[model samples]
Target chain A: MLAASGKLDRRELCRALLADRGDLLVVAGLGAPAWDITAVGDRAENFPLWGGMGGAAMIGLGLALAQPARRVLVITGDGEMLMGLGALATIAVQRPANLSIVVQDNEHYGETGMQETHTRHGVDLAGMAKAAGFPRTMLVTRPEEVPALRAAIHAGEGPLFAVAKVDPSTLPLVLPPREGAYLQARLREAVLGPAAHHQL
Target chain B: MDRQVMESRPAAADWPDGLYELLKTHRIRQVAVVPDAGHARLIRRCLADNGMRVVSLTTEEEGIALLQGAWLGGDKGVLLMQSSGVGNCVNMLSLAITHRTPMPMIVTMRGDFGEFNPAQVPMGSATQAVLEAMGALVRRADRPEDVVPTADATIRLAFNTFRPTATLIGQRVIGAKTFGKD
Candidate 1:
């Protein structure tokens, strides 16, 4: 019903973010909100795992520090975030302005059978991010709030953090059994765009 | 013990000295570290410097995933950890094998050179076999002089070949007392 209502704006929010820049996109762990964006767009790359939620964000930190001019987006899950909470302190110290971490909070490891997560207990991810030294953190529970979220993200150079509270909509489960080749191939094209494949 | 004598304390490798230059020359800007005694100096060098970033992980397997992200995100990076930690990294190594992500890491090996702790021997013996099984190339360093050249060559091999390479620095080189103090 929420998907039909167009009320959840997560798909569009992710679409806008993916389309906005030629930066790095790291899809770590599972239960990400950008699953649809990753499905449709020719850009964005994801890691395969039911664990390691904050893993993408840490990788994004590395990428951002490695190349400060390029933007980096991390699509993380609430459950995965719990596993690597310490990485947040590491991010705070690095403080890369080109990095933006988006936590798609659905309150569960949705892909791994809708297991309970910290978000289920009204855990404030934004507050957590701010406390971790991501000064520009925002929380949006509705889809319409995404535009402002996007604006804030682009305008605010970070080490910034944003949490988009999304409703659980049944999305395709991707990991082993289904090859990530398709996603990698499309994202490769999106980044290189007919150029020769070169190691970075 | 004289004040002037202590103050002079004959110079060492200048803290972050050749490390940043080495990483920059190789264009290695990201690092994944699983802490160990042998490579702690190099690992701490990466962490203390502002020029490069280190991603610390609970297990070494996560370093492979981090490397995948680093490669995809447009940064050439390396994993820094100890030899025994390789046992924890098998599944992630399989993922690297399947994905063909070229990762370069300096594994500070313990338990083989002198053999104090029996616990370190099993994984130390298993490290090379595990790496080979995962299709990763392994190299060892036994002296400080070998450190720079081996690192340079391994980094080159990893980037040029687009496959993982291990630089195993034995305790004989990084020193035994470096891990613990009395």
Candidate 2:
């Protein structure tokens, strides 16, 4: 069980959630979530969005729907998720069993100087996802809860949505490959094997 | 809601079927759409195809990201939307432009050539210019016969050359929405 401080350590939580991930495709949102995933050791299977705010979940949906046999995890921020809230409804309707979305809810726009976001004022992302009909929804505010959350993500019987409440302290920047094309190609090769090279 | 307009339109042309066949031939297995009357037939065809996955989005911008992800996962997809939806997709389109992601979009035009809704005019008239400004190649299919060829060209430009392309299916091709018929 984690401390009852009500705020989990972001880095520790990310590492736990992604620990021993095998064949899991990760799409990280811009800003802190991107840094968090890269901090976990960037790999060809991890495609971090340098920009394209609000797109992480939908991108995961596409990849999940395309590669149904593999699990797709999208790690994004509350502010980014709020921008594309409609995606929850869409994802629910499509209901890709292999998709999991985790919102690192520090409750602020970390990219734009930590201005407080709606989550700070009681916006419930997990509740919204539940209302949108996600099969699994969780709100994590403690370290102990992370193992269960990680289990749910790896379970692969979702359309799952989880919000991890984390301390808002700014962390050191951990950047991934800056070039979008290179990242896309690398992820493609990783997912499709040798066939990606033959694509025009 | 727009089924009445779709049903009342002129005898369906062969182009919608042609466009569908072309997409399948190119191995497009995913379709992201924001429902519009002009694309009714195409949407129906996609939904019926066992080999294709049709996803209905709340907004058009989601389609851009969805298609990019599909390509990343070694699949091809098409975005189906109306002209008004283009306004919602402007910034997200940058994902395609910046990443040089191949995107093929079929846009059904409104607010031109016998439009009933005054609200759709501004975005409709500016659609081509806005797409061009965002570095997307824009082509128009005004007549039934032009649909397949324009879509073919769009596919070539998008997948072969790694550019975003939009095929504008004019109101002239899909038939303008009729009003005052409750």
Best by lDDT: 2
Pairs of residues clashing in candidate 1: A53-A80, A97-A158
Candidate 1 chain A worst ten-residue window by lDDT: A173-182
User: Comparing to the true complex, what docking class would candidate 2 get?
Assistant: medium
lDDT per residue, candidate 2, A145-182, as tens digits? 88899999989999999999988888899999999888
Q: What is the C-alpha lDDT of each candidate?
A: 0.66, 0.89
Candidate 1 CAPRI category: acceptable
Candidate 2 Cα outliers beyond 4 Å, as residue runs: A1-6, B1-12
**Which candidate gets the maximum TM-score versus the true structure?**
2
Could you give candidate 2's per-residue lDDT for residues B7-86 as a string of tens digits? 63442376777878988999999999999988888899999999999999999999999998898888889999999999
lDDT of 2 at A173: 95
Query: How well does model 2 score by local distance difference test?
Result: 0.89
lDDT of 1 at A133: 87
- State how far residue B6 of model 2 sits from its true place (Å): 25
**Where is model 1 more than 4 Å wrong at Cα?**
A1-13, A16-34, A44-54, A172-200, B1-25, B32-37, B40-66, B84-91, B115-126, B143-149, B178-182
